[model samples]
Target: MSYVLCLHRWVGRQALYERYGLEPGMQIRAICTAESAQSLPEDRLASISTLESLDDATAVIAEAQRLIELHGVPHRVVALNEGDLLNAAAIRERWGVPGDPCAWIERFRDKLTMLEVAARQAAIAILPAVSAEDPQAVQRLLAEHGYPLVLKPRCGTASRGVRILRQAQDLRLLQAPHAEPMMVQAFCAAPILHVDGWWDGERIVVLTASRYVNSCADFGPDSALGSIELDADEHERAIAEQVAALLAVFAGQREIVFHLELFDDGQTLRFLEIGARVGGAEIPFLWREVRDIDLVGIAWELQTEACSRQRDHARTRSRDGRPLHGERGAWVIGRRESPLRTELGTLYWAQEALPAGVPSGVYEGARTRLRLRSFDRPALVRDVERIFEHLAQTWSASA
Candidate 1:
């Protein structure tokens, strides 16, 4: 029997099974971390295994081999987190799967490679960058880019391991020993912008543009980070076009869900970095609650489409089983979303990224998270500000 095997890393049934697990005559197995397994609905899965951590590619592959022996090769191997991409790629290779996420995943993960590819293919203006491979890499980059340079891991998320050099004295942070490979970028003084949407293999059909209230790199126990979806503006169309152009370079006008970040200095939009998966934080919730779009589900569906051609069956009920947010007949759509649901919004005070023994929140280490929506744009903005005012500012600095 063919079963879909998920390297499930998310906690709670809400992530994978809440919307799709009830389907009759469908088989889905999952390998999850012990923490995630606690909340995952065991009654639905064909069988489930546990892992201490998903990063151990070798251990996960051994589990895959054993699972294969029991259930045959999965129709597709699913991994939704960025850290899980390479592990999933390895599993796909071992199973002789058709998809090769590894081919372009580097462009998505490695910041240096990601910038080079974007510049070469889309004619996008990318910030000058150098790899932090050599011990003298920072010294060289400082000489070239000058002060106020930014250094971050080539493959990182949640703004972890990011460092900014405001003065010459900051060089110590770079010269000090480190394990994670880093990249140096000439810092741009501008508002950080992000464009998120789903691609239908032709053009960008569904997208929302937002400018960060505070930079993603600013997240900390003391800082509050969030993004507000931009209202209709003259530059919106132009920005979407640029994002579409860059995505076309990597995807070749093919199906993909993307989270793209760029720097806009009121004139030119500079490419920062992009991810093949959905945007983290409250983006998925914002898309669903505010836009009547299931962005995370769209991302999940793209993977199934990636590994197979079957179109009808899906984990979540995609609208009409057609281009989800594409222009097709009035966007009759979910039409205005219903009254705000309590379960729809959450505030994550802590996460695994924090030190052990502290309390844990929903999933990621979002000190404060909420998804608000209103047909009136002005009211939505007010609601966001209202919640922000009441949230506690101090969080544990276990990060």
Candidate 2:
């Protein structure tokens, strides 16, 4: 039996295990906080390990090794949750096991360093960003570059603690004592389009792209409504290729899996950021549907495969894997166009969690309310329009 060491005990672990056929009998180890560990599924509880100090790579890899030795070396050691990219690199280093290099993951995870490297490479146009810890330095840059800039945490995810600084006066609120260096970049009025794919070395095996309807909505801990549009063009592909090539340079000797977000400022493609792991929601599912490739599975093979011949397993198998029976679409609902002050209305659908109906102010996950209308893009569009109007009316009445 094979085993994979996932970093966090979140929804991602469950989904990966199920998708890769590693759920039952196979050992699935999860590293999480004590509180989260307690709530882990009973069947996989034995393999669940709790930790307090997973803030770095060394401690995490040590714990993983202990588990691996006790359970015997599993086929591949991978992480789906926190400290994963760190653990992956550490596992390869400490145990001589296969995993992504720490540097690759670090460059992807660390915004400042990523920008520096990208700039050095002259790979893609980027917004001028500086870590928030250097307030004076960022202020200096702002002075030189002007305002209407963006400030974001160096190591934050999903747009947490991100804010737009329109002028020098706006800097007052950003002076939190505990704030680390925030990445400050010149805000570009670019249409945000995300380019995602599975990479082995520099090779792009499975690729897909999408444009975001609302980037600001998903910028924080709130549910945001978004839908996916397929069929991109060569213009999008050219920019994605540049990102991929640059990432390949950054990874050097190590192999890695990556998801890069870029922007089209009408005339040019600009650098956004790259996620070391699989991207959230639509991108991952989109690849599987359109390319017939299981990015999760390919990542597993990349970590476990030893020889060039075995590389075929790492390739996408869309021609043979499950076929898409219908056109699929997903929508994330949240406080948008209206305030969350009243009963926006209920999400009606046979398969929704809130089948009883949703009241307003129920802001949830990245995908709060998704209507997966298969083979019905037109109907889905109409339904989404109606819902948005209903929400606006609901908020209007209360206001």
Model 1: per-residue lDDT, tens digit, 1-399?
567677777653325454442224556688878776766666667888998777677889999999998878887777777777777777788778645457667778888888878876554578888876664766777787789988788887767789987997886776677767888789998899888877677777667777776677775555556666666556777787777788877778567778989899878888988988777666665555434566666666666653221123221323322223321110000111122223322222222233343223222434334444544555545655544443322122222
Every candidate's lDDT: 0.64, 0.57
Candidate 1, residue 299: CA error in Å? 2.2
Indicate the residue-level lDDT of 348 in model 1.
Answer: 21
Best by TM-score: 1
* TM-score, structure 2 vs. true: 0.73
Task: Kindly report which residue stretches of model 2 are placed more than 4 angstroms away from their true locations once superposed.
Answer: 1-4, 12-14, 18-26, 33-46, 50-76, 87-98, 120-123, 216-223, 252-255, 289-291, 306-330, 333-351, 354-367, 371-399
The local lDDT score (0 to 100) that residue 21 gets in candidate 2 is 43
lDDT of 2: 0.57
